[model samples]
Target: MKSKKIPERLESKRLLLRKLNHTDAPGLYANIRDKEISRWLSGVPYPYPKDLALKFVLTAIAKFENKKRFTFGITIKGIKKEAVGVISLEKVDYKNKNAMLGYWIGKKYWGKGYMTEAVKEVLSFGFETIGLHRIYANVYSENPASERILRKFGFIFEGVEREKFFKEGEWQDYLTYGLLKKEYSKAM
Candidate 1:
């Protein structure tokens, strides 16, 4: 399957997934600044500096143009402009038709199915628009909520990598989940 540019916006029942922009820096920083929010995320700096947030938005813009990744800011429809979460497909491999999925929602947005909704839409974009054969996500072994979300989406349990990431000053285990194009088609 050939790759296509990700759409400017994707909508579900209550959420709109759109491209991140300069104006989003403050919201992105506010949402992700919490240690609880940043803990499981591997690369996000713990302090979550304002400068880093700005840099992230800029980098996200660059990555999208290069087709290296597609990142979306999650906002409630007709509720506000600030993002409550973010979701993205990174490490895209055109030859292998695969990519890595990553996402996080603010604690206030947890248990409301927002991430689930956003992820399902992003997964569709990955498989249908980007022509990905497989899209995978890795979760911290201790994070069952994330694991449950992946399971609900029909992502298969692939394997575990012990001490796979050094986060918050300690090594952590990671559980991998994957969904193939055929499986996604069936689920959809």
Candidate 2:
């Protein structure tokens, strides 16, 4: 597959999405370690490991350079430079022009519409910058809030993946959502 150019920084009305690095470890760890934030998240470990944030940051940097994935740390503009959330487009399939979208915000920042702004910018980057034709998201059945966000962004509910993952100590089902480039255009 050919290499893609992923922007290092993207700006929205109230947030800045930038490439995550080692410097973000402490802030990322602190924000994501909250049970409220990590509970519904699939990959994140409960009682998150002390070193996991730094490891993820390093992996994100390497993945970007490899053109395999693009992960951005989300921070509020002019409020603090530290990351309060994370978003990513991973498992890129250049042959099919598709990728999976994943994101999570700190519990303290919930209900603020910060994630909505971040998602908009990332969607634009995925469709316009990286030329992806489809972006999909998998939301756990229990996470209605995330599903609502997906719906608001024009993502169609495709189907459910039953017992798809073992997360937070139990098996969980996932509600799959997909948004095509055309659908996003129409939404806009």
lDDT of each: 0.89, 0.90
TM-score per prediction, in order, is: 0.95, 0.95
RMSD of each: 1.3, 1.3
- TM-score for predicted model 2 compared with the true structure: 0.95
| Model 2 global lDDT (CA atoms, 0 to 1) | 0.90
Alpha-carbon runs more than 4 Å astray in model 2: none
Q: What is the lDDT of residue 41 in candidate 2?
A: 80
Candidate 2, which ten residues in sequence have the lowest lDDT sum? Answer: 1-10
Off by over 4 Å in 1: 1-5
RMSD of 2: 1.3
lDDT: worst 10-residue window of model 1: 1-10
